[model samples]
Target: MNIGFFNGEFIDINKAVIPIDERGHQFGDGVYEVVKTYHSVPLLLDEHLERFEKSATAIHIRLPYKKAELKSIIVEGIERAGLENAEVYFQVTRGIAPRNHLFPDVPPSFTLTVKPARKIAERNYESGVQTIIVEDDRWAKCHIKSLNLLPNILAKQNAVNSGNFEAIYEKDGFIAEGTSSNVFVVKNAVLYTTPLTSNILPGITREAILQIAKEEGIESKEERFTKDFLMNADEAFISSTSVEVLPIRTVDGQIIGSGNPGEMTKKLHQLFKGLC
Candidate 1:
């Protein structure tokens, strides 16, 4: 049976339980990181852990273990769960305590789960995906990957109800990013993405793509882009741990790049797969 790690101990998911007084349960005071693995090898693990540490530190949530020890735990969890080409989820919560809006007094709780890899829909990968635009109503500290994601959840739900795969968040008519991924626009063979700011999550896959583009001699820039720019771009895509490199075929019912995957998108997808 697959194993899960809860508070530094391995247990079956069904048997793993937490107190109702857990601070994460009452206040959603937690942070998380998702790392992708290919062929039993974790990709950009150090970076993920770094972000994890930063997120924890941002909220004053202390990580129970050091980064190196946590990495070993994640690797062990992956192996124990028999995961190869999969996703590993790590989260830390403020732990159980009396109900309060403030930080908890108890130690933090850590959990890790590994699941079998699941690729995006075949059609999405083969042709492209569609995204709907929604206002960015999330908290201002979007740079920290926190677990309090009701806004993102609602936006994603709205997109799903509209038969779309993702939500591209708009702030003041500008495209911030997909609810849970980084947004990219390609025009005239140049890649444009939002700068790492307080408005969006700094994605690990996004960083890898930038490096890949550099090595492949592709021009890239970090600048603010409006929704109009996204609607008019020759190509667009999103990157995340769950969805590696996904082409955005449509934005708000308007066609993007012939309403199909663009040449640049295909090249990037191919290059991304080559890393595996």
Candidate 2:
């Protein structure tokens, strides 16, 4: 019974299909955004949509509809899903055309899908999660939320194969981010994370955490830190729309600090939950 918005129409998920020649499918030419709903309301929707538009613009893909129209479609699809807590995923791609690397003259195609939200295991929050550091092999434009996610997928799969919760991507020993989240470390009671650059996505949740920290008088810095610093930090965590704030207890089998979620991490997690 789930409903989805596909190419300007709302239809049953089963009936929503894309043409084989669609650029998103054929060339991975698309941008996407995932918004999580709490009490049937999307959190930081405006920020997410703004980032979506920026991503599309970065890749020269024009959105088929304006932000207001897209927001309406998201609301309609979420209502059809009938889930108080859900994840709304939407994407825009260059329309279907003959297989070619060159830009096509056709209009763009946009789709929205809503589904029940996935909750993280309580154990992960209580006992904290383990992760491994992997070499970042993604392209230069990691800030764009494009469909080209093969590198991220492989890194995440590597984490899964190793029986870990996530993969922390590092470029030349400097931590960039997680496979699907932003990375943060606490040292001497100061929270530090990567700078806003082309190396990492400017996560909405990450921004919220920093804002909360500022309001709470918690010291934070946006600067790159090396693997040695991360391994020896007092605490570490990852943030994203889905995970919110997840504690990192260990990395590459090396225990971080006392191998437990730090006081700052817990405080920030509570603040983030309140916002949600």
Candidate 3:
């Protein structure tokens, strides 16, 4: 039976519940982290927890437990699930309260769920996937991994309707990021991606890939690029905790480079897997 952690207790998944007036449900007031596990151990767990704390602080939500306590809770949930590979999702909300926009006096609500990880299709990694450009409609504080994701949901659905794997968001003609990943472009054998700003989430996988690039002696830059640059680049890819290094062969029906996963992307993927 699946198990989850909620309200400081481990319980059967079906028995877990959050109050109706919980701020996360009523006002989307929460921050979350998704840690992918390998061999029953969470990969980059420390980095994920650090980012989670930063996200909560950005939204003024005080986490109920310390990082060490939260880590123990996650491990316990994973042990209960008994899965070798899984995705551990944990979140902290402003807490249960009367329906109001103001911050409540009660402690924050912490919840965690562990489930089997879904592997991306090998064909996608081999032949790459198509994506469409969508106008970014999220709020200014995109850096925070908040529960407010209406715009991202709409854009992701739009990508699905367009027969694409993901949506690359653009703000004022500048490529920002993907609906759930970070965008990177290869131009003249150099890598370029958006810098850490309010326009995009500072993805943990994105940072890992950059570190790999540096270690592998691959040239990289964290500067923003225009739509034309993205469309005309030699190659492109998106990265996330789940997706890892997903190559983008086409964008809005325009072929990228040779319309295949680039050499640099394949190398980075192998290096990333080594780290995992």
Could you say which candidate leads in lDDT?
2
Clash pairs, candidate 3, are none
Q: Write the per-residue lDDT of candidate 1 for residues 142-240, one digit (tens) a residue.
A: 999998999999999999999899999988777888988999999999999999999999999999899999999999999999988899999999998
Tell me the TM-score of model 1: 0.97
For candidate 1, the clash count comes to 0
Q: What is the C-alpha lDDT of each candidate?
A: 0.89, 0.93, 0.92
Per-residue lDDT of candidate 3, residues 70-166 (tens digit): 8889998999899998999899999989998778899899988898888899999999999999898899999999999999999999998989999
Ranking by lDDT: 2, 3, 1
Superposition TM-score, candidate 3 onto the true structure: 0.98
Candidate 2: deviation at residue 16, Å?
4.6
User: Candidate 1's error at 2, in angstroms?
Assistant: 3.2
Q: Give the least accurate 10-residue stretch of model 1, judged by summed lDDT.
A: 1-10
lDDT of 3 at 221: 99
In model 2, residue pairs whose N, Cα or C atoms come closer than 3 Å (at least 3 residues apart or on different chains), thus clashing, are: none
Candidate 2 lDDT over 23-84, as tens digits, reads: 99999999999999999999999999999999999999888898898889999888888999
Answer with 1 or 2, whichever has the higher lDDT: 2
